[model samples]
Structures are given as structure tokens and as C-alpha cells.
Target: MHLVYHNLRRRLLKYTWFLKFLAFLLLVSTAIFLVFKIVPLLLKFPVQLVNFLKPPQSVLRTTSGRTNFILLGMGGAGHEAPDLTDTIIFASLNPQTQDIVLISIPRDLWIPSLRAKINTTYYYGEQKQLGGGLILTKASIEEVLGQPVHYGLAINFTGFTRAIDLVGGIDITIPQTFDDFKYPIPGQEAAIPEANRYEHVHFDAGPQHLDGATALKYVRSRNAEGDQGTDFARQARQQQVLTAFKDKLFSTQTLLNPNRLLDLKQTFSAALIHDLSDAEILALVKTAFFNPPNLRSGILDTATSSGLLTHPPVSARYDYQWTLIPQDDHQLKDYVRQLLFGQ
Candidate 1:
């Protein structure tokens, strides 16, 4: 009886070990299915998942249930003010609701802490330490917007153009016919003849396909005639191009093609600057994948009816330079808060 009892105990222990092994295999298989099969299918045919699927809250860093990122676009080498962050957009995503809000901060906005234009913060930060540009930029934006910034990404012209080209270009619709005769040719800013420095670019009001260079011009054209010449209009155009590029990037062709995705990764890796870890980056991609179609975008310009900000008159206080300042600090914060929280 004693021998039989000992033999039965040993068999029970063996059964327990087998059960553990099976559980381990099941966990791994589930992870693989989610990553390899489900994710790719969702990318190929993205549905309105926000209605049914809410992202796990612990996936990324967030403040007040909103994850915020600052996107900085620089002119890059060979262009004047290569380090200046001409395009500053504060993008906030609500994983619970999959709502995205894009707020364009003008480069000419003043930063009292740096005693300079907001655009110069990144440049000075880089001078102080490596990878400090994004840090400083994020801090400055947080101060102005009254929100915590979780991450920052800085992309130059090269990366912008190359990424678009890698995906075989993007499709954009010109909302209105416009002409930009002063589109400065790269590396020719100081050329002898001013006439030779800029080449004329025109687009009709209709659907159009744009290559890398032309798309760059479409977003960077700040000297177009009439309403299109305004910085506000340029900001709108930039957002439109960004939406188009994002759609192209996640389209079935791009998502399913391994070679194209690899090439894009290589190109972006060379030209992009960010402080995101591998896991954090994946989390953001997942957030975007499950996001809804609702996108709210606005530019904080003094000309807007909202009047959240005002153009302070040129004075020695601003070094005799034009800059935008909030009309009411409290109101500005409230405006941003409403955009993010709808409260």
C-alpha cells in the first residue's frame, strides 16, 4: 500500500508539469496570433474598432487619460535655419475613446523661459546636450499648452520626403487652386540672383497625385496668394498631407509588403529623432490602429475668431520681433483643455 501511494504521488506531479507546459505554449501562441495575424489584418482592413475595442490603459504613458506627443518638423540641412522647428503640432490621443486632437503651434510664438521664439528652444537645447532638443521642446510645449507631454518626435525634410517616396507617393486633393512663386529652392537661398533662387509651383483645385518634392512644396508653401498664403492655411495643408501619408503608410499594399516596410524603416531610422523605446513605439502604433476616424485639428493663430491669442506689437520686449502671445493665460489653457477633454 505504501509503494502504491508513492507511485501515484509521482504520477500526479508529472501530470502537473505537463499542464504547466501546455499553458505556456498557449500563452505564446496567443501572443503570436495577435501580433502576426490579427494586427496585420486590422492594418489591412481597419474597422471602426473604437466602438467595440478599447485599448488597454497600461500600454503607454498618459496624463489625465490622454497621451500627448509633440511633433517637430525642421527644414533640415542645406535649408536656412535647419534646426528651427517650423512645424510644431501637439497631438493628443485618447485610447479609451480613440479621439485625436492636433493643435498647431506657430513657430513665432514666444517662449519667456528661453527668452526667444518657441522655434529656437530645440536649437538651444541641442547645443547644450545630445538628445536635449526633444526634451526642451516638449517642456516648452507643456508650459504653453498647460498639459504634460509624454514624447517628442523631430523629423527633418529628408525623412519627410523619403518616407513619402518609399510608399510610392501619396494622394492629395488641392482644396483650392494656388500658386507659390517664392518656393525657395534648397541650397540656393543665398544664390547671386534672387530670381534663380525660387522656382514657381502651381496646383489646380482638384484631386492630384504628388511625388516627394512636390508634396514637400505643397505643405511648405507659405507664400501662396490670397488665403492660401496665411500660416493658418499652411498648417491646414500640412495636416491634410499628414493624414494622407498616414493612410498610405497603413494601406493594404504598404502594410502587407515586407520589402517596402523594411525600406521605410531604414529611411525613417536614418532621418527621424525621437526618445521612444521599442515597446512604446509599438504601443503608439497599436493606438493608432484602433483609433476612430474622428480627427480634430486647429491652428492657434491670432487671426482666428476664437481670439485665444494675440499678436503682440513689435517691441524691444520681444527684441523688436513679431510674436504671438496668449490673450488670457487662463483662457488659453481652458481652450486647450476643451480640445482634449471636451469639457
Candidate 2:
């Protein structure tokens, strides 16, 4: 009877050991799965295209502090083409204070140094290969503002359209009816095709829904009413679109879907070029969404506009110009500081 009891106890001990071994195997499998299988798949949709494009060591830097950056949008003449920056916006963010400020610089603003269009900074940068167009544009903006542009992101218009489409289009309220006679179609030449172009955009001056293509037209149409008949109006429209898109992104439905997040990353990846790392972008997004401050929109006054003149030696045909920036640097700085630090 004693032998029987001992044998039963030994059997129970063996079973316990077996169960422990099985649990260890399961844990090992899970670790392997995450390390070898799941991790690689997850990394495929990285939000760090800028990092991939320009490694940290290659990027140029100036003195670092809480400052602003310019987000330039270069609308190419055709698909995949690299053109001068058609849209330039200065954006400032303070990580500690969570302040945000955006200021749009008109593309046609005259810069005297270049003796060409304000957008010609891209051309100069590309010619010198300093940092492509973005570097030269940053320098020009810094010269204008009397403040350094810490970094910039230059995206092609095609990619911009794709990003809007990925977000399922942006809803914009048109304040007036307008005709965009020269809206260029993608894959076409610099000149707008007469047959393909829509001469009149007849949206009433009220809240209206717009798709990616229509939104592009809406912002690009300067001849429309209340458009200032200049690039300044275009800038305002662009900001409106950006604000609407941001609102949509923060919506509960879009934020909850992993698939939608991945789609957004992919969509922007094709268009965006920035100096920020994936980690930095994630941190910025968190701050921007959680405790966003009021976003003020303005442009350089008319007094700042320098007249257009042809650039010597580069090209007699192409004209360039420079515009005066705000006279008070402290005002600009203080405004940015308040936005970044204040509630």
C-alpha cells in the first residue's frame, strides 16, 4: 500500500513538470512570433518616410530653440514633376507649451535677391544641389522673416491630392462662386488643356462638400469672388482645407481604425518630405490632438510686396521678386510663444 501511494505521488509530479514544459514552449513560440513574424509586418507601414529620404546626419541645422518651420507645397506642372513651391506656410510648435502657429507666405511675393519669383528659391536650391529646393526656400524665408526656419516639408501636389483622397475627401464651405479657367490636370503639360478643363466652378457661397480634385480646384482658383485675386486668397483656402482635414482625422471613427491609420501613413508617405523622424512625428501628433491651441491665420501685408524683376545670368525670361516681412520680429515671436505656451 505504501509503494502504491509513492508511485501515485511520483506520477503527479511528472504531470506537473510536463505542464510546466508546455507553458514554456508556448511562451517561446509567442516571443518568436512577435520578433520574427509580426514585427516585420508592422514595420512595413512606417510613418518615417522623411527619415528614410534624408538620414539625420545629412540634414542641415541652425541654432535650436522654440522656432517656426515652413511647410511648402510645390505644385508640379505635371504628375511626378518637380516645380517651384506654389504654396509656402510657416508652422511653429512648442513641445513644452503645446502652442501652434501657422502663417502663409504668398508664392508671388517679390524677393529682390533672387530677382525671380518668390518660389524660385526651389530652383536655386535644385541648381546648387544644396538640399534640393527645400533648403534654398528655407533660406529665402529666413531672410524674409529675419528668423530661422528650423526645418521644412516640401510635398508634391499629386501626393497632396492623394492624401486628401485617402482621408475620404474634405468638406469645405465655399464663400462665393468662382471660375477657375486654368486648372491643370495631372499628367498634362504646364498649360491647362481647354477640353479637359472646367471653365466655371459654380458652387454657391455656402457650406459645401468637396472631393480631392474639386478641393484642389477650389483652393487654386484665384479669380473667384472674395479670392483677393491673388495667391493670398489661395493660401486662406488651403488653410481651411487643412483645418477641415485635421478635424476629420481626429474623429472617433477614423482614429479607431488601424486600417485607416495605415492607409493615411501610406498616402502621405508618397507626398511628404520632412526632417522629422517617425518618433518625433508621433510625439507631435499626440500634442497637436490632445491639447491643440487656437490657430491664427495671416499673411504679410501689401506694403511688403516687392516688384517683380527678371533674374540676371540665370534667365532673362524668368522673373523673381521679394517681399518685406513683418517689421516687428518680437510681435511674431511673441505670438508664436503665446500659441505654443498659452492655453
Candidate 3:
């Protein structure tokens, strides 16, 4: 009877081991399936879209091992007009530290002989000038900041709105109540009639939800608050939108959702123009998401006194000036270097 009991115990132990082995195999198979089948299919959307839009360019090999880019917004003429760049922002990322910095350049900031607004750089390039808009803009910015602009991505205003919507609109806080005169919609030659243009898109200064169109209005609206109706106000709004965007993009659900990824790729595919290779972009994306760095922002303070260039030709209501980087510009450059290089 004792011998019989021992044999039965050995049989039970063997059965338990077999069950454990099977369970381990199931878990391994699931993980492999996700990495090989699921992730590849989902990531392909952005990869293909990016390829279609910019294609890849040969980039200079770098030992600094840091990735940097410029995010440009062009407010070209007409709905289909392609002229100068309306906005230029330098964005830098440090893979090791995951820090980011965005610096905005005023389109009208005075550059020698180039009374032409910054956005006009693209127009100048398109005119078959010696250098294209991107080249001219990069030269101007590099002269001002004393650094190399490794790569740049340009987005149209419409594309910006579409991308925002694709990502599921962003949330922002209104600082005050204000009015936004209706501006002509792209492709519509007739000015939005003055009467129809004066829509009161007002919101109390506080936390609120904003859709893509409304958020565009919020950032582009200069007269929303009586006290805030200048380029400075616009810059602040731009920064706010950017921060909100980063937050949304980094959200786990947004990053992980295959549908959202595809939508994002499709929405911005036509609008985005970049000069980075697929490998570089993938590396940068991985670094940004896996190891994020602190983000910092600041504006250039010019010598021109307030209200000096209150009324410029194109948009009389807008302000302009011959802005100069402060004498202590090195401080700003150092901050940027630290953010980008993680040194």
C-alpha cells in the first residue's frame, strides 16, 4: 500500500509540471504575437505617411548623438497660396535626458535688406531665387542664434488644424475674455464680410475644452483680451498650444491606439514637409517617448519700445518691430545646448 501511494504522488507531480510548462508557452506566444504582428501593423501607418510626405534625405552623421528639429508654420497666401513661412520654431530633443525647448521667431523681426517678412523666405525660394525659402530662413535664424538648424518640418495652418483634430483636440485655459474678427477662410477670395467676420468667440479666462477649430481661433485670436492684443500674446498662445499637444501625444492611450496613430498620419501627411531620414525619425521618436526631457520656453526681447511698429502694411491691426536678441544671448544659447545635448 505504501509503494502504491508513492507511485501516485510521483504521477501527480509530473502532471503539475506539464501544466506549468504549457502556461509559460502560452504567455511567450502572446508576447511574440504582439511585437511581431500587432505593433508592426499599427506603426506602419505613421511610417508610411511620413515616407509619402517628406521621403528621406541623407543626413550628416553626428557623433554628438543628439537629435534636433525645427517646427515651421507657414501662413501662405490663399487657401492654396504657398509663400513665406508665418511662424518658425526651433525644437530640440535630448535622447539621454528627454528634454525639449521651443523658441519662436517673429516673422517681421527685422533682418538686413530683407524687409521681406520671414514667411516670405519660402516665397523667395519658390521664385527660383539662388536659395530657397528654407535655406534663407535657416540662414537668418542661424545668424541670429549662432547654431545649426539640423532639420525642419513645415506645416500649413489648415494642416495644423487637421492634425489637432486627428489627435482629439487639446485642452487649454483662457486667460481673459476677448473678440476675434473673422478672417477669410483659405481659398475664399472674398474677405469674410465685416459684419459676418465679427463673430464673438468669447471665453472667460480659465480651464476649458477646445476643439481643433476653436483652439486654432484661440491661438490665432489677438484681440480676445483687451489687455492682450499683440505679438507677445500670440507667442504665449502658441506656446500653450504646443505644450498641450505634447501632453496629448505622450498620453498612453493616444500613443498605443492604432486608430489614432493612423488618423494622425493621414491628417498631417499632406501638410508636413521634413528633411529627416526614416531611421533618424524613428530614433528620435523612440528617444522622445522612452526618455523624455524637461521642456523650457522663452521669447526674444527686442530693443524696440512698445507700440513702435503698431501698424504694419499687411495686417494694420498687427504689431511689428526690428527686434534684436538681448546682449546676453549666450545665456539663451547655453540653455538650449544643455537641453539638446544633455551636457
Candidates 2 and 3 compared by TM-score, better number: 3
Q: In candidate 2, what are the lDDT values of residues 1-343, reduced to their tens digit?
A: 0000011112221211112211222222233333343456457855444333342223334234354677776765464346677667766655545444555566665555666556778877778875667777877777655557877776666665665676678787866566555555555453445556335565667888777777767666666644545665665666677667666656676656666666655555555666654444434434433555444444433333232111133333333223332334454445443444452
Candidate topping lDDT:
1
TM-score of each: 0.74, 0.60, 0.61
Give residue 319's lDDT in candidate 1 (0 to 100): 91
Residue lDDT tens for model 1, 1-343 = 0000011112222211112211222222233334554566556654523311435456578889988888777878878889998678777878777776766677888887777888998999999999899999889988887889998877677876787787789898889999989988888888888898998989899899988888888877879998999866876777677768767876888768877766765666666688876455555556544543355555443445555557778999889998877767766676677667778
RMSD of 3: 19.5
Error of 1 at 328 (Å): 1.1
Encode model 3's per-residue lDDT on 185-290: one tens digit a residue: 4554444554543456666678987777877777767564466567667656766776686577667767687777666655555656666654555444444334
Worst 10 residues of 3 by lDDT: 1-10
The 0-to-1 C-alpha lDDT of every candidate, in the order given, reads 0.69, 0.53, 0.52
- The CA root-mean-square deviation of candidate 2, after full C-alpha superposition on the true structure, stands at 21.4
Candidate 1 stretches with Cα past 4 Å from truth are 1-56, 170-179, 202-209, 225-253, 290-294
